[model samples]
Target: MGNRTAVIVACALVGLTVSTPAFADSPAPSTYGRASYLLDESTGKAMISKRADKRVPIASLTKIMTAYVVLGQAKLTDKVRITAKDVRYAERGGATTADLRPGDRLTVKELLYGLMLPSGADAAHALARTYGPGVDGFTAKMNATAKAMGLSNTSYVNADGLPARGGDGYSTARDQARLAAAALRNPTFRSVTSTKSRTVASTADHRAYSWTNTNRMLDAPGSLGVKTGYTRAAGFNLAFAADRKGRRLVGVILGETDSSRRFDTARSLLKWAAKHPVEGNG
Candidate 1:
């Protein structure tokens, strides 16, 4: 009887050993953002989620949708002439700009670089005005697209995500993760977001311009281009994606108080996700 009891105990110990997770000894990653979400891109499985449903301002990450909408309607080669109105719109908001000049005829592709790389409000205004035929019209399309995409926690008030009277645009980390995953599927978006910097040479119609990506995680291994944003109200934000041995992960961090720490938190989360096994959506 004693031998039988010992044998049963031994078997239980073996089972426990076999079931132990490889990452059991590692601490879970810490995040500085008020909210965050991470997902396995291939399976749409959630790996990490925090305050994922709490809506908050998203700042210039709004440009991700802006680019998505424009990519759907306009060809990359389509030309858009920058107007004084576009420049003024950005400047008046005290928002970031690409320093784009009025009367400069730039291709949709160039404007995208300006829009994304620097998080340029002017570029967003230009694209919205031309594509929507008016800012209000373009904003409507943004809301429609968000609804169609099933991003229930998201809403847009303007093209560049500047503060509006009623509210600045808002979204949850979970919704932003889903949006980032969808946007990364487009090759043009992947290319544009992954780029670290872009320089368009001076042409007869436009002046030479250069812009740099705001996403610092681009330098990390397997990092993919997504977007970054900040405002006094929004804090630091990032929608990030990365691939490790063909396994891709997409994530969003919102309301991080420190700009550089947002990237650090993202990298730590990615590393944690890679080490652990995928689980059900959060």
Candidate 2:
């Protein structure tokens, strides 16, 4: 096995034996997803992992990377005019939308709220077009960023995580945990994902809009905004982060057949990890 794969296996094995006094009587969290991973964000230790390296379609979780790339290149105040094509792309795909209107102009910051909160394919297209100059160019940046971040098992074919004609975008639980760690470090990215709701007042340039986050975990204590995604092919997917007593954890659940179960599993894992705090490298 490759050195990296070997290390992951070792960590997964270690995670299996970890337990603490706080949850001595509690059973370990049971995950219903096909793949799941949890990490101690401070030390990069694997806390709980199951088939973490298995690659699968990621659905709207693709938007996390989309936001990451856009934050790297665009100023929050920069304006992008919504195009009919952008609106049409989301509608034709029967994808979620931010309800952005064509001919209306909104800032990059506003669009991000639309993108992350509603898992808006329309908002993703607008940002991709503005920053990438086109969908192809933007997705190229997404793939390049993934490689640079050392996410070997992840690939992106589109900005919004929608399935491409050839194939859908794919990623493993472990790679996604790492990606969430990197993304949560960015203040703008963190703020956008954590927001439960955002309202943009109407102006002459654009219509008013309000977006509610799709991530249900946001309401939970210590929950930090990350991202959530779903598609017929991808199943219910979630990349999540939480903080407890200054210790932070990041996790990903992919290929969950049940929507509510994904969040339940995440909460269970987070609560379990809080009790079994990582010491040193865990």
List per-prediction Cα lDDT, in the order shown. Answer: 0.85, 0.86
The residue-by-residue lDDT of candidate 2 on 42-85, one tens digit each, is 87788777788899999999999999999998999999999999
Which pairs of residues have clashing backbones in candidate 1? none
Off by over 4 Å in 2: 1-27, 203-207
Residue by residue across 31-111, what tens digits does model 1's lDDT show? 656788888887667766667789999999899999999998999999998899999999999999998988888899999
RMSD of each: 7.0, 5.3
Highest lDDT model number: 2
Displacement of the residue 183 alpha carbon in candidate 1, Å:
0.4
